[model samples]
Target: MSLDTTTAMPTNGRPIPDPVPNDLTLPQSVDVVVIGAGIAGVCTALELAERGLKVALCEKGDVGAEQSSRNWGWVRLSHRDPREMPLMVESVRLWKGMNERTGAETGYRQCGITFSVTTDEALKEEEDWAQILQEYQIPARVLPAPEALNAFPGLTAPIKGALYNPHDGRAEPQKASPAIANAFRMLGGTVHQNCAVRTVETSGGKVSAVVTENGTIRCSSVVVAAGIWSRLFLGNLGIDLPMLKTTGTVLRTDPVPDGPEGTFKFQDYTFRRRLDGGYSISGPQTGLYEITPDSFWLAPKFFPALKSEFTRLKFRFGKRFVQEMKLPRKWGATDRTPFEDTRIYDPQPDTKAIDKVYAQLQAAYPAFQGVGIAQRWAGYIDVMPDIIPVVSSTEGVRGHIPGLFVASGLSGHGFGLGPGIGKLMADLVTGAVPVVDPSQYRLSRFSDGSKIAPMEGILRR
Candidate 1:
């Protein structure tokens, strides 16, 4: 099948009004230059600006135009990787107070999250994951069959049990990064849209400045939060970042009352009630992994992860292979890069998979039988080998690029973990004490002979 490479701005379920305008003049110098205007970049800039540091956030396109807004908008911690639990714990706290801090409506609400299981084996998995939650003192409970059915009504299937996290929540992906960017501007931070950073300029083996498509911006430090483009950007610097992309398709329905209040994941279908009174739905175990040149090159490193997720991921080959082959990996600052060609990475939705999910949803809940599909869209998720994120500095890592930090490769958890990861990146960039231990997220784990693997649990998005 031919891939749809249409270069249009992503339709993020809801319309984002009154975007923060870009700074007309790029500052000659700033304390830090953050690449990519996704949630991670915006939040990092906000934290740094609040610390009285001059920071500039440069994006290839509009803020949150990519996976930041294209996600399922779930802010959950019920089934997190144990290594990321602490950071997620802190992230939920940050999310609760985000509206007051940013003075913007992020649409965050703690309506709770439910992972419904049908089989005895699946129930055991949730129970085991709940033990990890208990270790971290998280208040997630596993409801038995009868109680689970009572907690979530309209379920026609026989649910053995469910893992419930009352503190877990949902946020509007459409409004999150933009609101954070506006908040960053309020704190005296610079935001540059349509500005693609070609490469980082090094001075004495440290980041000195960045050459964007608009112009050069001198800075002492740089944070690479470029979501799917981080690997390519770092590749030009001779740094091998083991990152890959997977396409996630989602659809939203018109305002349909009588739906479940919180986010829910059944055997195959997953959904969350939108603030707009509609429901955002997708398949819990469905996504496409378009085979690219990187697939072969990074296969060895991603072997464990591939085996772990073999049941969920589907492999395909087509235009994505050719498009990635045509992407200029080692571009000079003067050359027009692919980032400029595709301002926003809006992939076509998997209509077949979406139809299957919608059918399953209606079959499970008769209330949704008449729900009308309002919109459907897809985005690429920047996945790391271990299916976790790397939020670390380059101080002691191999390649040891000083004055540089990265908070990318969030797998699919960037939206929920953005704020906490941003705070951690700020702490690393400013040489302040970090909020969580940063050893697990070091970039060298892939190269240092550490066994890279995903934690045992149902993958949550």
Candidate 2:
């Protein structure tokens, strides 16, 4: 299979620069092939192309439709895993200039991120994190309750205080992914959405081509950036990853006269003040549980009491969740057909959850007292058992495969760390000085009898 590098206008309406003759076909062989169209894949392609390498990036779905777009858009420098801080720090820099890089409105904001704590335990943990961040010269501090209220002016709830990181901010993940993908195309890279890689063709123990539904793309190297689906790709090469899908629910409020001017996180979930005077809130990033279709049925088997209440109270189940529960248990493990309806897993707002979230928000900040609930949606994210991302090449796979790489297992931090990981992966692919040490994210670490401990809940955050 060859790429007919004809500069045809994209059906999606994004402009494509004219393709040169050499660009018309995939090189009989290429320098690299990247799988997954999310941040990691596009970023790596852009970086490699910038360094003068021929790269091809393919995706099983539209870019960022999964964990990348499904995340709570916090681009903060606070509450980072020490190992991931370098990436976090550099991500903030890239985020600040993302518009120039992608030529798109990504909703980037540097309004700062505040973590409100009401207990001595949470406060102590915040203090500890402050010390570690300061060690890296990252600005972080625990503000007094009075000062916190003064800073935000609308935080009316009673609490000990809050930890503030001025360098932290956010962007609209919904728009950023596509924007970056467009940027990658403009930079002389190739991206194929709805194109799934069937298998990595290898010869003499080296990757020779990426067989996709469209055609065979011969390339010496491949990078796997598929989010939760990354493990499935590696499985094709005989590698098993301890990654799972975790669901999160979020709610939006009707445009109000006023709302919190910035973003906030508390015991129940975090709330981000939207540009439209509404707000978005979600569950704790670490609280999602392992739930299979059977788990819904198993929820009753495991906790008959909750099941009884679910039936007795007529507790509502999100449509997607209910449908997912009806599917065979194997569906979660084996369903691989990629759909174009981007909303295959898109969920409607949970009224009950929204009411609870609204109450909590009102309790935490009174300004939300009369905020009318407008809409809500839910999404799933990829999570590692240990909650640390495992990113590296598969062992025993070499040669043409030598250039193959991986940058996934984001474990709910994809939106926040996408830019940083993208930058680092790009560096590794181009063989340039890495933005952050790769050893921290090497996949072999977990197999070599060393395990990275999961974040200590709010303490580590």
Candidate 3:
């Protein structure tokens, strides 16, 4: 298929220049065609290409232009859902060796992560969570007041204790995905940027090809890792994916001397040091939800999650509500879809929230009082009703769409879980032994009469 050479508008977040040139010609056919060039997509392509399968990765925008690059760069297993703990464990293991495996600096570092607490109730909650981690042989522990202070020196505020994980880590958000994509390219995988896939074409009730704005490519399997755009993409194929989006704002500070060496999440804010000597900071618990048509349609499925995280999510209705209402939910393969309309989901940063977090950071640690803001931006996160990702195939069921697999709905945790999830996805596609049990992340859970709720005592951060 002949491809287009149009370049997308420059993304607004941290700049991640193209690390590898995109493939201009779409192959006539491949063993597997993965849609969306985010971390999951590239990782999946890399795994398949390394396994000697012809792979093609398609992206509507630049790699990691959305949540992958806009995140706080935390690769942690400190306070994960119990169901996701195993996957996170494997993900951290992959992250530790990612730079060597990919031959690119992913900026991964085992700097540890700490959650500070100021009250006995909060400390008890951390202690309870630590007990769960112990069952998995994860080396996470709770420190008492004196010990917590000594572990995290330079704290002016008094704290009862903290939950510390020495193995938790961080990676450069802008560098990780592109590095993996480059690795895939080195392994003979094809990547197409500014190539928005309009719809997947099926034949004989099975996968056949995908129709992109550029053209069509035949394949036996397809993996949709389009992040926030996954719901709309699947909806076009008559699939009801229960997903909603929340906007998260963040800011980077000028390189300041002697900031916290490790990632830290206190009562009001979170911050982690960058490789460039600056610090990425944001409100650990703050997120803005813009009401949309899907918000009402999927409310029942998300009621439990909404109630559990009500204190952290701020609701608003304005341009976003009107904008989403006007977006076409269904489109033909030949049509110009919303994916082309907005190449990247770049939302305006909530200055109110960013400033509030900055103020709290200064109040909690006086060292941040003189830090200068370098840049501020916002990205939308796609969250599932259960706050867990769906990583299953759509085959052999009633009215099944064979050879279709989804690895989306990461719920703001994609960056840390990308490598492991990608490896698992490659196994699922090729019918090999999975790296971790895949039953918990099955897509059928939403429709199979299973009770959906966040794991007990899971941290919102």
Candidate 1 residue-wise lDDT, 1-461, digit = tens: 23323323233443342377788689999999999999899889999999999999999989988888888999988778878888998899999999999999998999888888888888888888778788878788899877766655767767888998888899999888999999999988989999999998989988899999999999999999999999998888888789999988898877788777877888788889998899889985458889999999998888877776677878899998998998888988898988899888778788778868988988888768877777777889999988889998765556778998898999988899999999999999998999999889989887888988877543532
Cα lDDT listed for each candidate: 0.85, 0.65, 0.84
Local lDDT at 296 for model 2: 45
lDDT of 1 at 35: 96
Name the regions of candidate 3 deviating beyond 4 angstroms: 1-18, 396-399, 459-461
- Candidate 3 lDDT, 1-461, residue by residue in tens: 11112223232344453466889999999989999988888888888898899999999988878788888899988788888888898899899989999999999999988888888988889988788788878788998767665644666657788898888889998889999999999988999999999989899878999998999999999999999998889888888778999988888877878766778877788889998888889885558888998889999999988888887888988888889899998889878999998888778887667878887888767668777776777888999998998887865333358899999999988889998899899999999999999998988888888999887556354
TM-score of each: 0.94, 0.80, 0.94
lDDT of 2 by residue, 44-137 (tens): 6776776777777776666666556655677877877777777788888888988888787777889788888888788888898788889878
Ranking by lDDT: 1, 3, 2
Instruction: Give the winner by TM-score: 1 or 2.
Output: 1
* TM-score of candidate 2 against the unseen true structure: 0.80
- Global CA lDDT of candidate 3, please? 0.84
The candidate, 2 or 3, that scores higher on lDDT is: 3
